[model samples]
Target: MGIELLDRTALVLFSGGQDSTTTLAWALDRYDHVETVGFDYGQRHAVELEVRSVVADGIRRSFPDWGDRLGEDHMVDLQVLGRISETSLTKGMAIAMADDGLPNTFVPGRNLIFLTFAAAVAYRRGIRHIVTGVCETDYSGYPDCRDDTIKAMQLALNLGMDTRFVLHTPLMWIDKAETWALAKLLGGDELVDVVRTQTHTCYEGDREHIHDWGHGCGACPACELRATGYRGYLARQQA
Candidate 1:
């Protein structure tokens, strides 16, 4: 990355989840001005939307250095996406595998649509760099979260919008464990605590039970991945 890129403002596709929170911290560390964009797509885990402000406020309070770089936040109403998406994420159906072998929790074209909207916002805000946390290693077979999908979206966004917009996925190759480690690396224990207590990742949107890793239903795929990753992160820390 060039110094010019670092100096330019960045718009982060922040969903108030662990991955996006960490990515937000990553952007704050690199960019001089960092803005955030979240989508209210009517996901079953809508609670994540509620925590977005809390997480941002937590970061601002705990990391004053990075807080100075934090800029505006944009919340795009994408309820239409929920109306069209029949997946478990948008619906109240039980999480299961579809006949095509992919999990029902996979929201088709979610990241693609999200990137498109983020690009539009970035264009209006004069931001050239767009950061996201979509990863393939721990993506749970979500096609939209794949590295290839993100690259293609970046190309399409730039071509369709007639502007140069670079989509940055810092967690593209890292697993959940590495993601946890990245948060610690970016903002130390403070960032980790914010992510653990403030961010939401459970597919079922369960916040009642607080686990060692965080709050979740503890049985959902998301909660399982988060818990398992935290254990691995802890083990590595001990070593």
Candidate 2:
């Protein structure tokens, strides 16, 4: 691996999913010190924080001497900050369990709130880069995950905080297949194994029915996106 991304400190919005996991590994490769921030905004997968903690601690064991270098992986609880909404990811909402209607999973302003908090944390810690895993392609139609939204947040963060902070969506335009390829390209097989085996990506949170690569009911929007990526990946390998 050429590993161009190394030796700088970046604050990654790590979500304990494939995309964010890839971004975390990418940051680790590029930055000397890599810190991660996770928002616990009453999402269904808030339990994934436990997942992130395990991953972060494993990273620590790998580099025992670099306590400060790894930075902190924050799991900020935003339940009170979240208002009652229709999105399945928010408080006081009935999740459809499947992407049958409007995805009921659309937490409006989710990415916005996350980025806002992340930007604040980064500025306080004097970190400038905020890495997210929002990919416009092969997603479940989250408006906040779009490229325009991310750019707008970047501008707002700079203007609001009076600092030149950069919002880096490393997986912005890439499809799920491309994201998986990135894991292999940047993080190597070992990190890829870690990511595939861990990281929650299911609305149902059914880890038992999942393979090492994907999860959930296998019919929901998240499952569909993941399945699409899985097929694409297999096709690539076979091709």
Candidate 3:
């Protein structure tokens, strides 16, 4: 059976990246009311933070139906995460594989902390659903992105907060290619264009160079995945 649309409100963890933007579209399509939250954790690719407003505006202007459903946005200051994390995303270091076979770009406990804060905000706002874009497929080996971890977090949030907040990971099982397709499916070419032109996913925070997929350094792992996924998406379309 097809999933039933929830008439409740949702708060999406939107970072203005392709995946997050896509997930925002997904939430806007499903929920009656939708809000957004972003974190300023002093990452190297802070450009993603700047583009959040632009992408949100694009969605508001292009897709009026979703625009009507879209609601307020929130920003959280988690610079402490940056201070505490020694990974490449939080620090000025090379993106390399660590000894434990994970990318240095993996900021430890990022999704966990994000969910905790999001749940707090949701608890106050009386929102029942919290949406995020963390995916294991086509991801950079982040343990927190795993399905099991998200399920555990969901259980822990309900127990700790005493609220039955349904954590939504719409992109958890999908890869980058399918993600592009999902954008197209959710909002058509206009939404796809918003994702391709407005979102920022480069780890190096280089928005000066624009590619067909979007703005990025095109060499970072994030860019590589996005670009490869776009290519695969196109190939499937042509196939």
Off by over 4 Å in 1: 1-7
TM-score per candidate: 0.96, 0.86, 0.96
lDDT by residue for model 3 over 78-179, one digit each (tens)?
A: 999999999999888999999999999989999999999998888878888999999988888899999999999999988887768899999999999999
Worst 10 residues of 3 by lDDT: 1-10
lDDT of 3: 0.92
| Sort order, TM-score high to low | 3, 1, 2
Top model by lDDT, which number? Answer: 3
Per-candidate clash tally: 0, 7, 0
What does candidate 2's lDDT look like per residue over 114-216, in tens digits?
Answer: 8999877777677767789988887777789999998888888788777787778888888988887887777556666666667767765666676646556
In candidate 3, stretches whose alpha carbon ends up further than 4 angstroms from where it belongs are: 1-7
Candidate 2: clashing pairs of residues: 5-29, 5-30, 6-30, 7-31, 7-32, 8-31, 8-32
Taken over the whole model, the C-alpha lDDT of each candidate is: 0.91, 0.73, 0.92
